[model samples]
Target: MVPVDTLHDITARTFASDNYAGVHPEVLAALAAANGGHQRAYGADVYTARLQEVLQGHFGPTAVGYPVFNGTGANVLALQTMLPRWGAVICADTAHINTDENAAPERVGGIKLLTVPTADGKLTPELIDRQAHGFGDQHRAQPGVVSITQSTEVGTLYTPAEIAAITAHAHGLGLRVHVDGSRLANAAAALDLPMRAFTTDVGVDVISLGGTKNGALFGEIVVVLDPGATPGIEFQRKVDMQLASKMRFVSAQLLALFEGDLWLRSAQHANAMAARLSTGVAAIPGVRITQPTQANGVFAALPLGVADRLREQAAFFYDWNRATGEVRWMCAFDTTEQDVDEFIAAVARAI
Candidate 1:
């Protein structure tokens, strides 16, 4: 890890990505508080119970949660639970499962992934229907799962109504619906809806409830919303190496974050910061907003010279659409108005 001083010494520039920012204070404190504890191994401690309570509140008393290392792990483990030996999963073309999972769903879980087109990082019912073509023909891969990202990688959100529509269509077609809530907290806060408005009520079968992105350092809760729909899920998690041996510590962080509404607080702050950055960047000359800043991410096509100048300052960001020439700016829990303003000033100087 780069030293904090080294990071702080960098020139005046803010990264356009949420992942670039550091962990929030509350999460860090939870981790520190858990440092010297010797309780139980493999999720049998009080902290794990607390964390489950946190999730139960999110999805009502019927929901359960498990902590995994990362978003990808949480997603693959959760998806695998709902799939049979030969059943396949469906997702957006840009879904992390389709583009980013390194084929774990296929290689490890022995399931296929069917990808469909996405508009603004969201999958509509029309898109799902379009991709579900030729299923059960014995001539094509079967469609059995609907996996969607929230606060999608492109920083867009699916409204509760939109999710309900997609879920209804997928369920009617005899498919289980999974929400890759890797950024679910962000989407929930942005929509101003209760978590259950989309999860249990909107027809989600399983949800990879996110904690890593909003605030937690390394924890994502795989919430089993439909117990009957996904039996043998706990065993799957254990076999897949997602079951935290020291589960209490990880869960403690979540409880401290979620049970008291810290998750929404962090996500709301990040969304606000992203909005601030988007507004600032759009005002600058030669910078264009590539997408609506709906969540904690901003996509733009800045002048090449401006990008170069920002990079020279050790600013962290990524060229999301290199061929089309655009960059992705993600905001995080700790991002401040000062950071956005500084980035704006740097852009002003460069442009």
Candidate 2:
């Protein structure tokens, strides 16, 4: 029999996105462990129940987690449950929901996104106020939630104090807060704080707890920190087609991440690699580090034609801003020091 590694080029690596990385070994082992038993379906299994306790441990006692297939599903379901039929969400213009999820929040979830342009991807209370107004006006789509992305799309982070201010201001206005925490672990690792520091304790009503980008095969959880914040989430999950009939498998993968310290270790490693990449490229002339290396992602502006030249070396990454020649490179839990060094050398040679 041929080795599985020969079927594909396992040596190929990319800075495109963490989603490109394979599953963690522990998570794969967990999946195998959960496979033999005839567990209950649709989240009634022991694994799902244990996932709840594990999540509550990190997100606080009031937190309730619903496992979903992907980040888009989790975000849409969370938003749908948090809003009324005419509800709108306030988010940064660069948010994944606003720009990347292909408008799933609007088209599928039936929620309107009121996007604000920010210098960085982080949104402050002042930014939220721009779209949080016109209450009791039938003409306007009422803003019921202020959604922000942690370790935002531009690779910038919002401190705990900043998150508290946003949540405080939003809640004071009879609005709830939702965090698109796809990179939540990265934020926690970079800030040297637990997940709860910037979430449950800071007044964030709900969060999309990410796993795929960390080390899982595929899964994310929509965690309701405030019990009353998102009603009908159970039904909303099914309504949005995010319900997994074989949910124990999903739950088991998530448990493998949070039940131990794998989540933090993976995120910390990814963040460290990004920091190394940022430092390496900053020394190259004409390469401008666009955003602060706050998490596992690094954004930079490359000299014209240099990006195309770099791509020729098979070091794949995304062009963030075509107009500005800005690009994004994401590091995964599996990104090695050697990978970063090789990419840096390639960039130097391309220049």
lDDT agreement with native, every candidate: 0.81, 0.93
- The residue pairs found clashing in candidate 2 are none
- Tally clashing residue pairs in candidate 1: 5
Candidate 1: list runs displaced more than 4 Å.
1-16, 35-37
- The top-ranked prediction according to lDDT is 2
191-277, model 2: which lDDT tens digit per residue? 999999999999999999999999898889999999998888998899888999999999999999999999999999999999999
The positional error of residue 306 in candidate 1, measured at the CA in angstroms, is 3.5
- Model 1 local distance difference test score: 0.81
TM-score of each: 0.93, 0.98
Reference-based TM-score, model 2: 0.98
Candidate number with greatest TM-score: 2
